[model samples]
Every structure is written in structure tokens, then in C-alpha cells.
Target: MGLLAVPQPYDFERSLDRFTFWGVDRANVWYEGGLHRVVDGREVRITPAEGGVEVEPFDEAIAPVVRKLLGLEFDLPPFFAFAQRDPVLADAVRLLPGFRPPLAPDPFEALVSSITAQQVSLHSAYAVRSRFIDRFGVAFEHAVAFPTRERVARAEEQELTALGFSRRKAEYVLGIARADLDFDELDTLPDDEVEARLTSLRGLGEWSADWFLARHLARPHAWPAGDLGLRKAVLAFYPDVTDVRAAGVRFDPFQNLSAHYLLAALRYR
Candidate 1:
């Protein structure tokens, strides 16, 4: 057990809010007292620390996961500086300073989540996903490891439908899990290539591809132009921006981060 110092301007509450905004589900994550995760066969706990976050049972195996989960690689000063040029973004940055875009610890997990989230209300998605995880995932002390690819690949369509997944969604999940694609190698691909590769898979479309880029790859320029939440948030915040996708072009390389902040702002507002 050890403490990991997060970079300055980190707001644990804001970050936690974003993490749990969808809903509480111990099947995947637990946040009653602190953050808990089961990663690489180890149970790790994270709590607020004076200068950063404190991790229990910290080891090298969990280091990279924590870094990516908390977005340690992203330097926010430049984003905050850039936000000043746009009133909506400036407000979002000010409202949620120190908030960083959270990444999916595993690309496969992100892919599963993207599949589960399709065409459903986030609340419904969360409930169904929670049920699915509780049914198929391996349990830990306070959390469950997201179901493995092998497990999901072998899941029966009827079993998934019983867990609230539509037949099509079940097929999509199984297709992704059984695919020959190497999820780890996706990080090494260029943004366009990543999109092309992901979209090639059955059931994964533009929305899924865009989210994988933003949440899994953490590509700074990746933007989900078709995201309804983002479009609503942009319209609510910037009334003149009739075309959210076109409006997002202004943010360029930082559009992903910008979209994240906008989403967070909408949640808190």
C-alpha cells in the first residue's frame, strides 16, 4: 500500500462525480469511501490524499492502469489556457477546474461499454450493464473485474438478453470479444487507422469508433461529433453553434478534452 501524488489542480470530488455520474454499481466499481479497482489480479484502493491520491497495495503492475485511469499523462494547463478563447469552454473549465478526462483502463472494456450504451438512455445502459457485469464478471473485495473477452465471447445470446441486452447488442458484444483483433495494438495506430480498424468490426460504427478514440485511446483530437449529449451540451452552452460538429472544429487537437469538459459541465449543471 502506498500513496500516489496526482498532479496539481486535481479535484477528487469532481473527478469522482464524473466517474459515478452514470450510477453506482459495485459490480464494476465501488466508491462509497474511496475508489476501488481490481486490476491484473490485484485489488487496489484509492482515496484522497493531501497532494494527490493514496493507493493501497500499490505495485508496478497497477501503475500504468492508474496513470491512464486518472489521465496522468495529460497536462491541463494548456487546455485551460486554450479554453479562455471560448466563453462556453472557459465557463466549463472554471466550473470544473482540475477535472481530467477519465480513460477506460482496458480498450476491450471500453468497446463493451460502447456497445452497451448504443441507442439507450445512459440510465438504462447503466442498469443493464450492471446486471451483465454482476452476472458474468469475477468478483473482488468491493468490485468486479469486467468480464473477460473469452468469457464474453462464449456468452450465450439468450443469457445476454436475459441480462437486458438486445439480441443485436449481444451479438455485437460476442463479435467484439471473439474477433482476432489485438486490442492492445490499437494504441499504436494512427487516429484514422484506429477508426478504420474499429469500424471494420461488425456492430461498431462511427459512434463506437469515435468513443474508442476519445475514451480508450485518449487521442487529444478525437471528437464524437454525433454524440447526442455533446450536441445538447454544446447547444445549451453555445447557442450560436447550430452545428455542433462544425463548431467542434475550432477546438482541433483538444476537442476530445473539450468534449469531456462540456459533458462534465452539463452533468454538474
Candidate 2:
């Protein structure tokens, strides 16, 4: 075990709280305990250190994964500077200082999560996803690894439906798993190209693709304009904005981070 330093102004507790929200806890993401599952097949535990968070088993190898998961790659100075210009976002920035947007370490997991979230409350989505993971994921002492594409691909649509996915959603999940979509290749593609490719797949649409960009690729401007929570948050925070897309335009290149802060504001409100 080793300790890795977190970036300045990174609130480990707040970040964990957001990650573990909506009963979406997983063995791989133990927010309360600060343990995360890394792609290199290791579990790292994070805790607050003097000026940063300490990670156990802090092999430099897993540093990138840690940074990605915690949104440490983002330079907040620019975002904070931009936030000060908007009243609603200014208040959000004040209320949720040091809150960085969290990322999905796995793009496949992010897509599956987006598919599960469609037309359902977050609580419901989390329940269904938990059931799906419990049924297919590998379990360890502390956390369960997310099911691989191969595992999910092998499952029948009926199996997914039985696990609480709607019939359409089950087909969608099955389609994605079976599709030859290259998850790894997406990293090299621009946002528009990625969205176009993803939307071409069955059951994937602009909404899912947008979230994949936001949560998986961590694209700074990726905005899910159709998200109900985002719409509600925009309405509550920016009353004059009847159109979410217009509000998104106002945020411009930082719309993704703005969306996250808005969601956090709604939670803390």
C-alpha cells in the first residue's frame, strides 16, 4: 500500500458523496471508504492527507486511473473564473467549492448506466443496475467488479429483463454488448464523431451518447440537454431560461462542468 496525493481543492468526502449518490454504490466504488477499482486489476484506497488525499498501494501505475475517476485532470481555476460571471453558477460554485465532476472509469459501464437510466428515476436505475451487477459481476471481499462486455454480451435479453430492465432497454443493452462497437477506439475520436458512431447503434441516442462523452470521455463541453434533472436545475437556478439548450450555449465550453455543479446544487439545496 502507498499514498498518492490528490490535487489541491479536491474535496474527497464531497466527491465521494456525489459518486455514491442515488444508492448507486458498488463494490468497485466504495466512496465512503475511499476505495476504487482500477482498470489494471488493483483496488486503491483513498484517504485525505495533509494537503491532498492519500491513496493506498499508490503504485504510480494506477495514478492515471485515480485521476480520471476523481476528475483530477480538470483545471478548476478557469471554471471558477467563468462561474463568477453567472449568478446561478456563482452561487453553485460558492456552495460546492472544490467539487469536481466525477468520471466513469469504464466507458462501457457509463453506456450501460445511461441505458439503464432512461425514462426511470435515478433510484430505480440504481436498483436495476445493482441487480444486473449482482447477477453478472465478479465479487471480491470489498467490491464487485463491473461485468465485462463479454459477460454482458453472453447474457440473453430475457435475462436482462428479468433483472428489471424494460424490454426495450434489455434489447438495447443486448444490442450494445453484441455490437462490434470498439469501446477503446472511441478515445481517439472527436466528440461529434463519437456521438455519431454511438447513435448509429440500436437503443443509443443523443442522450446516451452525450452522457458517454460527459462521464466517460470527460469532454469539457459535453452537455446532456435532455436530462430532466438538468432541465429542472436550470429552471430552478436560471428562471429566465425556458430552453435548456440555450442555457447550455451560455455555459459554452464548460457546459459539462456546469451541468455537474447544477446537479450538485440541486442536491445541496
Candidate 3:
């Protein structure tokens, strides 16, 4: 098998439209001098050598699947029609470049990680994730591989607390891990069913589940309704609104793409 090495300057400034850009907050990805080295398949390791990023494509057999899975190929509509309606949103989209979603190999890991991220400041969520990775995660070469349920099912709350999780959070995390659930069974069900399964987890609310569904599963219509940033953003554009939830009515068909489009449009400035 052979490999394809492409070096993308890791800037999300105008590129948050990609499908794989998950887990990272917008502001974090755009900080000066930060590079996201995304490795494709197990055979490919994206190492940053002295000269620049190296894309060693060992075992070329699986390159196509890797490319497809990693979103190395796409046909972006010349213009996202959704960006045209609101003048402010249009301005932001123009200012920011377009991007893809950053996804993980394991859906379960992504789900749990996104769960721990609920209702917290971006900094705290990141700190919690890092500490959790350091404790429960394993190093698969460069990437800190999120641990599987079998591995973490037996983890103690005190152990997780030592890793910076709250007592309640630790219990919730362990409960999911111990259940031998991949959650893929819910995938074929309708969206509401998926929502039902996720929000039923203790401590997860409609908003948190909605947030998780939006980023991880790429649900085409999520708007993160209860988010303050979202509320503020919605309000910034509609200063007259006493009910911000109704403001979301403006983005009916394009709600999923609206957040990144809005963020990208407004990110640089």
C-alpha cells in the first residue's frame, strides 16, 4: 500500500465548515501558532519533522478508505446559500474561511468526551479532558487514545476524582463505560430516539444532548438553543428579541451549518 501526504496549515479561521472539526472550541483552534496534526490511518503518522509536517503513507492499500473517512476529498457548493440571508452572518462567513468537521475514530469515546464538556467553560472542559486522558487514556504512538468501556468500566470514582472529575461526573462516566454500549444501535433509529437515549443519561439535559448530537453525529438541524454564546450571538443580530428561542426561527432549514458559519464569519474579528 502507498500513502498520500497533504499538509494543511492548521488554521480554522475560515474553515470550520469541515465535518471533522469536533471537540475543539472555535477560539482554541484559531489561537496563533497552533497546528492540528491529524493522522489518517494507523499506517499513516503525521509527524512534524524539523522541516515541516511529514505525511508518511505506509501500507498504501487502505489509502482510499482513509481519505474518505478523514474527509480529504469533498465538493463544496460554490456558495452556501444559507450564508446569504443575514447581512451580519454573511459578513462573518466571508471573513472566515470554510472548514470540515474533525471527528474521532471511536464514536463512544467522542460521546463521553462531549458529555464531560457540558455546562462548563471551554478552559475547564479542556483541562478535564486532558487530565482524563492522562489518567484513563492510553498512548497509541502520538495520539492519546481514549480508553474503551471494557477498560474504564471498573474505574473508581476516587480515581477519576484524582484525575479532576467531580464525584457526580465520575459516577456518570463510569456508568456508561460499564454498560458495554457502543451506542451504534441507536444510530438507525430516528433522531428523537437518539435524543431520548442520550438525554436519559443522568446529568445530561436536552441542551447537552443537543450539543453532543450536533458536533459528534453531525445532525443537520441542531442549534445549541440553550447555549449562552448562541443566545448572545442570536441576540447580537436581533437586539429587539425578548425571546431568543424564536430568533432561531430565522435559521429553519440551515440551523446545523449556521453556528460554524456564524462563528467563522465572526471569528477573526
lDDT of 3 at 193: 78
> lDDT, candidate 3, residue 69?
32
Model 3 deviation from native, Cα RMSD in Å: 5.5
User: Which order, best to worst by TM-score?
Assistant: 1, 2, 3
Scored by lDDT, the top model is 1
TM-score of every prediction relative to native:
0.96, 0.94, 0.74
What candidate 3 gets wrong by more than 4 Å, as runs, is 1-79, 180-182
Error of 1 at 90 (Å): 1.2
Worst 10 residues of 1 by lDDT: 24-33
Each model's C-alpha lDDT?
0.84, 0.82, 0.56
> Would you give me the overall lDDT of model 1?
0.84
Which of the two candidates, 1 or 3, achieves a greater TM-score against the reference?
1
Give lDDT for model 3. Answer: 0.56
Model 2 spans > 4 angstroms off: 27-32
TM-score: model 2 vs. ground truth: 0.94
Best by TM-score: 1
